[model samples]
Structure formats: C-alpha cells, structure tokens
Target: MNKNIVITGTSRGIGFELARLFADQGHQVIALSRNADPIRALDHPNLHPFATDLTNEQSLKEVTQQIKAQFEHIDILVHNAGALVNKPFEELTQADFQKVYQVNVFSVAQLTQLLLPAIPKGGHVVSISSMGGIQGSMKFPGLAAYSSSKGAIITLSELLAEEYKEQQIAFNVLALGAVQTEMLEEAFPGYQAPTTALQMAEYIYNFALTGQQYYNGKVLQVSSSTP
Candidate 1:
C-alpha cells in the first residue's frame, strides 16, 4: 500500500536519501527542508518537496496546516532534522543551546503535536537521535549541546509512545553513531566515518516501515563504532 510519509532534513545526507528511497518505492513522500532545490531536482512524481524552517514556531504551524489540508493521513513521520554546534562547553552560550534545542527538540515536539491529528491508527513516529545521547555512553568534548538535545527528544518519544499507545501510533527513537554525512563533514572536516548516509538511510527506511509492529517507546542504539 502506498503511504503518505513525511520526513525532515531532506536537503542532504541521510534525510535526503530517505526521501528518495521512499518515493522510489511508490510511496507518497513529503520532504521538508530549509532548501528544497535538491529534492525538487529529483523530479520524482511521488516526491513532494516543501521548504520549511523547523526552528520557527510560525513556520512549523503553517507547514503542518498545509500538510493536514493535503494528506488525509500521514502513515510515517521521520524527525530526521538536527542542529549541531561544535564548541567547547565553556564557549557555548545559552543562545547556542536554545538554537540547537529549537531545531532538535522543540521542533520535533511541536511538529508531532500539530500533525498528530492527521496520523491515523498504525502510524509510526521515528525520531533520529545520537548514540552520545544515550546515558553513560561515550561522550565527546564539543557535543554537550547536540547530545543533550538528542537526549531530550529520546525521552520525549518514549513519553509520547506511552501516552498514545492506545491510538496505536507507535513512537520510537534511533540513537545512531557516526555517519559520513554532510553534517558530520561540516562539523569535523576531513574526518571519515565507517557508515555512509545512504547506508544509514537504508537501515532507517526499513525500520520506519516495520519496526512499529515489534517496538514502541524503544531507543535502539545503531552504532558501528565507539565515540
């Protein structure tokens, strides 16, 4: 069955790949990104690109309204967008935290809330987190803001899963390790990762479609390396 799916951060990296993968599979995909050119270039009939600013509340509301008015039901919602700031803890400011959380945490919650009505029974909500977000996991120096924000979303998914369990709208979180994505390259130039964006997207694509049947409110650490 073709599904009405929504995904964020579709301009580049794993999110971009995920959008294309779903569309290629004959699913109706709404790809959200600040810049929609890349998605538009795909020219896939099943792909619908919408430029959206996740950090802005007004922007989110407008997007959700448009989404609800278009798609009668959203079968899958992938919160794949993230904001990262690579700065020492001492150098990070309150505003830095706010910026990261706004994109990584606040937007996820707001988007879900606004779109919840359009998600019917058997819908799945998958949040992309970081292995660093897992408590007691390997911590890095300049990722205090990024990791903590991911952690916040992880907990939020768990709670939402429990609250909406009766509706059969399963919510799950994936704490991923290092992936050689544009975001990673921008944050740590010249560094290489064992996993590529396409590789990770393939994993997420399968999980989003079928994992809900066996898991809800679960945070799976999908890591291939330490750190």
Candidate 2:
C-alpha cells in the first residue's frame, strides 16, 4: 500500500536517494532540505520537496503545517538531516556544538513533536545516526561536535520510543558507518568508503518500511566497517 513519508536532508546523499526511492514506489514523500533544488529538479508528482532549515523551530513547524495540509497521516518520518563540524575539541566553539546539536538533535525532537499528532498508531520514526556515536564503537578525531550530536539523537530516539510505546509509534535509531557521501568527502577528503549513498539509502528505505514491526526504540548499527 502507498504511504506518506517525510524525509530530511534530501538535498543530497542518502536522503536524496531515499526520497526518490519512495516516490518512485508510489509513496507520498515530503523531502525536506536546506537546498530544495536537487529534489525539486526531480519533479516527481509524489515527491514534495520543501526548503527547510532544521535548526530553526519555525522552519520545522512550517513543514508540519504543510504536511497537515496535505496528508491525513504520516506513515514514516525519517530524521536524516545532520550537521557535521570536523574540528578538534580544543578548537570547537560553543556555537559549533550548538549548531550541530540544533540540527542533529534539537530539530529531530522538535519536528517529531510537531508531527506526532499526524503520525498514526503504527507510524515509524527513524533517526539517522553515526556509528561513531555508538558507545564502544571506534571513535575518530576532529568529529567531536558531529559525533557527539549524533550520539545525542540516538539517546533521544530511545527515550521517545519508550515514552510513546503505549501509543504504538515505533522510534528507532540507525547508527551508520562510513558511507561515501558528499559529507564524507568534505570531512575526510580523499578517503573512500565501501558503501555508497544509494546503497545505504536502500537499506534505510527497507528498514523504515518494515523494521518497526520487529523493533522499537532500538539502535541498529548499519555499517560495514570504519575508515
């Protein structure tokens, strides 16, 4: 059956691929991103690309408003937007942490809260995290802000999952390993990751559709290896 889906960070990378995958499959997809041009260029009837700044509460609220105007219920919500500042802890400023957290954690919570009413009993909220955010996982340098923010969302999802369990809405986090995305290229120039954005998006797309049936509030590490 066709379902309504919302995805963030659709300007590029996994979010971009995921939006296309769902829309092409006849699902109603709301693709949110700072730069809406990429998704907009697709011009798919089922895909609605909205310009959104996840760090801004008003911006996120507006997205929910648009959603309410269009769909009766949301079957899936993917918090795929992220902010990464690859800098040493000593060099990282308070603003850097705030910016990263604002998008990676705060916005996820804000958007989810706003869209909660529109999400039906069996809705799935999937948060994208980094493997570096996982406890006991290998950590990298110059990612204190990015990695920490990712970790925060993982815990946030867990908490939300528990809080909303009775409502039957499943909240889960996917801690991803290195994927060869533009973000990775910009952060670790010249480094190659085994997985591509499309490959990872395929994984996320499948999980978002069916993973909730088996798990809720769980953090699944979706990764091949670390670089």
Candidate 3:
C-alpha cells in the first residue's frame, strides 16, 4: 500500500533523500521546508512540496491544515529539521541557544502536536536525533547547545510514544552519526563525512515500512560501523 508521508526539512540533506526515496517507491510524499525551490524542482508525481518555516507556528499550523485536508491521514511523519551550533560555551549567546531550541525542539513538538489528529492509528513518527544526544563524545568545545537540544528531542520522542501508545502511534528516535550533508560540512568544514545521505535515507525508509512494534519508544543509533 502506498503510504502518505509528511517530511520536514526536505529542502536538503537526509530529508531530501528520504523524500526522494518515498516518492520513488510510490508513496505520497508531502515535503515541508523553508526553502522549497529545490524540492519543487523534483516535481515527482508523488511529491508535494510546501514552503514552510518550521519555526513559525502560524505557518506550521496552516501547512498542517492543508496536509490534513489533502491526505486526511498521515501514515508517517519525519521530523528532520535541525540546527548545529558549534562554539565555545562562552561564545554561545542566549540567542544561539534559543535559535537551536526553536528549530530543533520547540517547533518540532508543536508541529507534532498539531498533526497528531491527522496521524492515523498504527502510524509512525520518526525524529532524527544525533549521537551527540545519546552520549557525549570527546570534548567538542562548543556543541553544548546543539547536544542539549537533541537530548530534548530524544526525551520528547520517548514521552510521546508512551503517551500515545493507546493510539497505536509509534514514536522512534534515530540517533545518527556523521552523514554527508550540508550540516556536517558546516560543522566540520575540512572533515570527511562518514555516511552518504542516501544510505541513511534508505535505512530509515525500510525501518518505517517494517511495522515493527519493538522500535516503538526506542532510540536506534545508526553509525558508519553498523551493518
């Protein structure tokens, strides 16, 4: 069966790859992002692109309403928009922390809540977290804000899964390692990325299709070493 999937941050990175994969597989994909021009160029028969600034509550609400009106129910929801601010703790200002939290945590929670009614029973919600959220790596110096926000995402997904267990809504967090995306390049300019976006996207799509109850409320870490 072709599922109706809604993905955020589809303008690039893992989100774009996932959107392409789902559409190619004959699923209906509604992609929301601040920059939709690239996604619009995809113009796939199964792809629908919506320009949305996730940080804007009003815009998000309107976008969700449109999605509900068009699909009635969403089979899968992928929250993939996030920000990375790497700097010394002293260099990080309150604005930096607020900006990261707004996009990574606050907006995500709000959008999920707004769309909860449209996510049908047995649907799945996937939040893209990071290995930084699971465990602290070597002292990165200036990743406190980014790591803290992702930690909130991990906790939020777990709490949502438990709260909506009766509704058959599975909430899972993907704590991914380095992937070859613009974000990675921006974070570590000269460093080589460890994984391709397509590889990560393929794995996530397959996982979503598995209907595996065991994944519910779980945080799965995907690393370059993982099979």
Global lDDT scores for all candidate models? 0.94, 0.92, 0.88
Regions of model 1 farther than 4 Å from truth = none
lDDT tens digits, residue span 15-109, model 1: 99999999999999999999999999989999999999999899999998898888899999999999999999999999999999999999999
User: Rank by lDDT, descending?
Assistant: 1, 2, 3
In model 3, what is the error at residue 227, expressed in angstroms? 17
Clashing pairs for model 1 are none
Against the hidden true structure, what lDDT does model 3 obtain? 0.88
- Give the C-alpha lDDT of model 1: 0.94
Judged by whole-model lDDT over C-alpha atoms, candidate 2 comes out at: 0.92
**Between candidates 2 and 3, which one is better according to lDDT?**
2
TM-score for each model: 0.98, 0.98, 0.96
RMSD of 1: 0.8
